[model samples]
Target: MKGTVLVTGASGFVGRFLCMRLISESWNVRGTLLESESPSCLADKVEPVTVEPLGRNTPWTHALTGVDTIIHLAARVHIMDDHAADPMTEFRTVNVDGTAQLA
Candidate 1:
């Protein structure tokens, strides 16, 4: 086995593909899901874990267990037409602060 890897946003586009590739490479894969249910897109070998509301306060201890590497793909994106009063803050909360907390 290549070792266990934790993939954040495993249900997302790129994440799905990456998880498949990692599985094929003989790595033990653990995938984070925003929802409680497992995603149909995820491969059978990928262990699914819930880590909703990706942000600074997201609880990650369960997801990080036994993980040799972390591939962080989760982020707030595609808000070009956002009408929020402070879109940057939302982005920073998830993209910057969330990532910082994860690291």
Candidate 2:
């Protein structure tokens, strides 16, 4: 109950709100974001972790340590003009693979 809560995609809209709520409840929060993404405004409130692309070389192992709970909010967001790439692959990489790695 007194440990850190890891929140992935903490810079996103809903993720930011969730992190704020957790902070209000007095829980330590650690948030993760991609390298290209900007730092969250909540960075001052929670520890900000920049996660590399999901792969064998990525450093996701260390991020899960001491984490009491993991709230995965990172995923391949849908777009209107996004017919250039395979959505399923993107989703699997970010959502499925990412979650598996964390688990």
Candidate 3:
């Protein structure tokens, strides 16, 4: 085992590839997915954990157990035509506060 690594957004394009690479490198990969998302999309050997609405208050204790490293790929991606009343705050909530909480 290279080490235990927790990868957020493991079903996303970049995340899928990263998980594959880590798997090939012999790391124990734990992936975070949405409650409705399926773990079948991830690479073999990945341990999937369900988490939703990434934010400061998002519960992470269950996912953080024995994790040697965390590669945070979960974020509120920028939309070209974002319709949110406060887009910046939304982004900050997930990207900033959520990441901070995870750390």
Candidate 4:
């Protein structure tokens, strides 16, 4: 909570609140969003980074720099018109694989 923290799904509701609160408490917050830059951030306290959720082979070296903690909030949300043949597999690809990519 006090050290450098990396947050995933930072464009979402929970991620937004968490980053704001952490900044208020004097925590160095680094958040990851799908877009190049999303939801803006505190110039001094929080750094917003752009990253894909299901990065099959993306390297997280630069993103994980100086990060002491990681809060994984990223997920593949189910939409009205489903497309993936296997929802669980798709979920694992993003949620599971993504987490590994970060770690």
TM-score, every prediction = 0.88, 0.82, 0.89, 0.77
Q: How many residue pairs clash in each candidate?
A: 0, 0, 0, 0
lDDT of 4: 0.74
lDDT of 2 by residue, 14-82 (tens): 888999899888889999877787664554588887889764345776788888888888766766677
Off by over 4 Å in 2: 41-44, 55-58
Query: What are the root-mean-square deviations of the candidates from the true structure over C-alphas?
Result: 1.8, 2.3, 1.5, 3.0
**Which residue pairs does candidate 3 place in steric collision?**
none
Per-residue lDDT of candidate 3, residues 1-103 (tens digit): 9899999988888999999999999999999998888889887889999886788899999998999999999888858899989999999999999989898
Q: Each model's C-alpha lDDT?
A: 0.88, 0.78, 0.91, 0.74
- Inter-residue clash pairs, candidate 2: none
Residue 70, candidate 3: alpha-carbon lDDT: 97
User: Which segments of model 4 are wrong by more than 4 Å?
Assistant: 36-45
Please report, as a residue range, the 10-residue window in candidate 4 with the lowest summed lDDT: 36-45
Whole-structure CA lDDT of model 3: 0.91
Ranking 1 against 3 by lDDT, winner = 3
